[model samples]
Target: MSTDRTDCLFCRIVAGDVPATVVATTDRAVAFRDIDPRAPLHVLVVPREHHPDVVALAAADPALLADVVALGRQVAEAEAGGQFRLVFNTGPEAGQSVEHVHGHVLGGTRLGWSPG
Candidate 1:
């Protein structure tokens, strides 16, 4: 596990300090049920280590980024039966409410181009 931020909600979840409907967990990351799901099979895959966003994570190690994405694919296949979308919100303007980087797996229905 990586160093955690005391105030990060995803960090808390990673530490088991907070409860979440975790769908899958790996040495490097975790996938949990989204509190506010947009699709029938919506989940959030976050790294155990905190990164401000995906770009930051990518800068550190492409492999770790790949791991997180691979986890997202697994979540999608299990939850959506192989058809899904992977979305990453890079900043507040992009709709990322949490500071921790995460990959969203949404499917089981058609996802629109605009989240609106």
Candidate 2:
């Protein structure tokens, strides 16, 4: 929100200061493989601009949120045969580790239903 959070890890990744296994990228977003994958096809789609969480992103830029989702779909299609789950963890209790808003693309196998 403040232009770019210099200390945010994803911002560093976007700025090319941090190394990441980027899979797909657009002018508004970037898609990269998750280091600790919960699924076979685990990738993260994040906007180029920094936002604290998905709600902030959506409120500030709905179109960018759509772009992030669109990119997630593209990643799922290419890596998971067009079937996937897109997850947005909004807070620490919700499993959001990074401050930057991102959508996790999970697939490549039948996912179990375990929300807890």
Best by TM-score: 2
The sequence of per-residue lDDT tens digits that candidate 2 reaches over residues 20-52 is: 999999999999999999999999999999999
> Candidate 1, TM-score vs. the true structure?
0.94
- The local distance difference test score of each candidate is 0.90, 0.94
Model 1 Cα lDDT, one tens digit per residue, 1-116: 35568899999999999999999989999999999988999899999988889999999877889999999999888878889999999889899999899999999997789864
lDDT of 1: 0.90
Query: Which clashing pairs does model 1 show?
Result: none
| Residue pairs with clashing backbones, model 2 | none
**For model 1, where is the 10-residue window of minimal lDDT?**
1-10
Candidate 2 clash figure, as a count: 0
Tell me the TM-score of each prediction against the true structure. Answer: 0.94, 0.96
